[model samples]
Target: MHYTFSQYYIYVIFVAVMAAFSYLNKLNRTEVFSFFMYAIMLLFAVLRIDTGADYSTYIEMHEEAGKSYFTDLFSFTEPLYFLLLKVLYFFSDDYWLMFAVVAIIIYTILFLAVKKLSIDPALSLLLYIIVAYYFISINQLRQSISLVIFLYSISSIIDKKPGKYYLLNIIGFGFHYSAVMAFLIYPIVNTSFSKKTLTIIFILSIVLSPVIEKLFVTYLGELDTLYTKYFDIEEYMEKNYLALGKVIVPNLILIYSLIKFKSFTRYEYSIFMIYFCSIVYYNIFFGKHIFIRPGMYFEIVTILYIPIFIKKFFDLVTGFIIETLIILYYAFSVTLYGILINGGQGVVPYKLIFSR
Candidate 1:
């Protein structure tokens, strides 16, 4: 189960080239590179390298359903994604087409969201690339599509249109039920955070960890039973629990920074901190299923704030060399952890599409 040296070599070379181009383009901030980056990431997604078994499950269901029946109508938790994928499956069996459609949808929604936020296009593009490359690789059909819908819905929230926001979530939930939880967090979207509030939330997050798990396992077990054929409790817990540390550590730092700096808007801080706390608490007790499952959706919101904070941090720090080093560190570390170690978990392995 070891990757051949050629595999490693090719990955290293591809990343090195992309990094170099990224660094060079940061100077001019060209639109060409941004588009190029989008295309590359989309192509990678289509290749379907390192895709999870859920995709195969999706294809099988579609093939079995034929034209007379809706294949995923009952078995699927997310009706929106099921329907979307079913439509795409009609055109071709190539999973890449599905990936490409999702990538385009996500990119379009993100572009609109960031532009409305008044964030710089180049920075937004960079963050989108990072997300597309690092996060959307594994669950190409389910998670990625859900993420796009979720982000579009979040952007609607930013516009102060609650009706549109909830509508999108409803649509998204048809694709994945986990998306429904996102709607639950809407009321607190723009809530203010004080030192006292922050402390309380953090303390509550820690304290509620175990209690939440007990309740979920006991009460929500019915939900699991309904989808038992698709989900295994033991396996879900194992994968999520193992990955908890990876999500919590960085998130904690982000939370601490947000509080200390007090830079984010009240709504921005509230959503990020609340979601961050939720993820940590859920992961600590209930395991990764509660964390990683929702964590992908959370990332879309959190990522929007990251570059803004990074730019603010750079402005406050006032050292060009240090900023350069910080960016480089993130690029290399994120790329390695995201791609190399995780088998490019979120990255589409274009080379493996036909191989699989």
Candidate 2:
């Protein structure tokens, strides 16, 4: 008995309403609201919708590798996601149930991590919704799980423990090699910045814009071919470019806010500047493929910074309203992408569960 689009829409609205109510009741116990949000996200995961070819690829790997090798191969860098999936596979063949459990765990971790970092619950919740519903909800198995690992990695980095950060990055890479890029950032992120250094980096970022495409084509063409064979990189790149303008616009706003507020810690400033430069460079030459799609991962960081900037620049009430509006905007935008543009049908791809 497949659920219809109307049924899924009702389910989503119910969850969203519940989340909103919990968010509105600030005087209520924090744990209670947090738990309710987690529960709603779990339900959404249980009734997940996936489309496009990524699902087919995951299922193919599952069938070809069996349970053991499936974990071993996929765990390459994302040990937590691979292990979690393996445990679920051992218990049952119900992919939807497994996805729900994973989603709950991911959201819970992100919530706790943000709280530990001294962020507001409302802002943290907003970040979770943006990532879960907008960027990840439509592709629960690979990208969503990979995002969980990425969040953990970021938490470790925030704690100022390089060892743990590296280990988490390794785990993230196991699930998705793209996460390896986070490690390459340690040198840049850890270094003390001077005005001269910032100028050099900004210059390099600008200069690299046009040449990046040619460099990728000439030097990294084989790598591109390999990615295409394994991950359908071309198709994703094409679709990603469609909304390039929208993605770039928000990032530009974020950069402007960061510069105008000027209250960032050195580390925070480094992250903001580096990512901002990357976004600009990506926008100029490669269109949206460079920053917009991958940039979604940084939304969590961006939300955290936005609130800090708001607090520094405006009164608490005004800051709160601004953050709330940002959250609502991101939430609606993500919802539209997942529900309307992505043709989300609330059907988990059962073939990816186990060998039939």
Candidate 3:
């Protein structure tokens, strides 16, 4: 889709409104306000038309799935996702219905996750929008569904129940294969890593990145799939190359969390490790885009972490100064960085399903 500078500001204004609702009362917004906030987000996602990067592509896929037999799509697309498309298509041929259904499922799980895990639900929901996960859902529907499913699995992870966690992630994998990466979280979070060790590992991942790329190209890139084709297509690969927001900003957050390492509760530490893995993957697989998809399973959890981190860090050390700094950063990042810098992932010039 085409994006313009004016539309970017419009998208920023939309997000600014969402932020106003989120920060209106961090401790207590009435249930009616909560309902309104969620309804706005849900409607924004559900009603969009030709607004996301993959809008037309997913529309084509939806039409194709409706016309094809299950066996035809099963070879490439995940079974459950194909099934979901088939079910939605069966109800109506309208592709908008598919987007609406997926939006409902994703936001529902996200809302539940924020309620269960977030120390500040409003802040977590705000991060969901400002951090671009909400927009990411508008674009990459299948993987976004899988990502939120992984979010739901955090409770299972924290409860230390391997069976339940695996079950949830297995369901996630059925939506997107990249969810296989989530299988490692149980062990990663369960194990304790010293701050020194995490730092060493982060440094090593960056230093060894070239070698990692060579290994991926020589071995993994040989696979004959759209994902693996990135290595061979110079232009495609260049466009998909890791961005500053994906790498540096996240690593900075990881560093910020590690700064208060000694005071971490088990739950907070688990959250930190999950986010840490996201940056590690970003660094280790720096060049190619396909390998980076797995990191999102971990990166998305940072929405939950941000609010808690801000609160804990505020209580322990920096006070409102750092809190103000973080809020300002989020405000700028959501408006300027997201729309102007990242192009809002092609979600500008927002249009509803009713629009031409």
Cα lDDT tens digits, model 3, 1-356, are 23566666666776778777765755465555455667888988877788876889989888878887877766755778888888899999988888889989999888888778877777777777766677778788889889989998898878888899999899898888989988888999999888899889988888898787677778877553455445433443344322544555677767776676665787788787888887887778765667657778878887887776777766735654555555566556543565444564666667777775
- Which residue ranges in model 1 land beyond 4 Å of their true spot? 8-25, 48-55, 65-75, 92-96, 114-135, 207-245, 263-287, 316-339, 342-356
User: Model 2: per-residue lDDT, tens digit, 1-356?
Assistant: 23445534643564367557546645664666655665665655455434333555554544333367553754345555566667677777655555567556666666665555534556555555553343344454555555555555665554578898788667666666566556755565566655556555555665775577566666766765554432133454444332432354355555555456455675466446545544554544453233333554544455455545556666868876766676566555544344334443233232222332
CA RMSD, predictions in order: 5.1, 5.8, 3.7
Tell me the tens digit of each residue's lDDT in model 1 across 1-356. Answer: 22444554545565555555555666776566555655665555555554553566656655543342475466756556667667877887665666667757766655555555524454554544443333443455555556667766766666678888888777767767677667766676656566676666666767776677677677775665564422343564343322433454445556656466656665466446545655554445444243456656665554456545556555645534443554454444554444444454533233566686
Estimate TM-scores for all models: 0.73, 0.70, 0.85
Error of 1 at 305 (Å): 1.6
Which residue pairs collide in model 2, if any? 76-174, 77-171, 77-173, 77-174, 77-175, 78-174, 78-175
Pick the lDDT winner.
3
Ranking by TM-score: 3, 1, 2
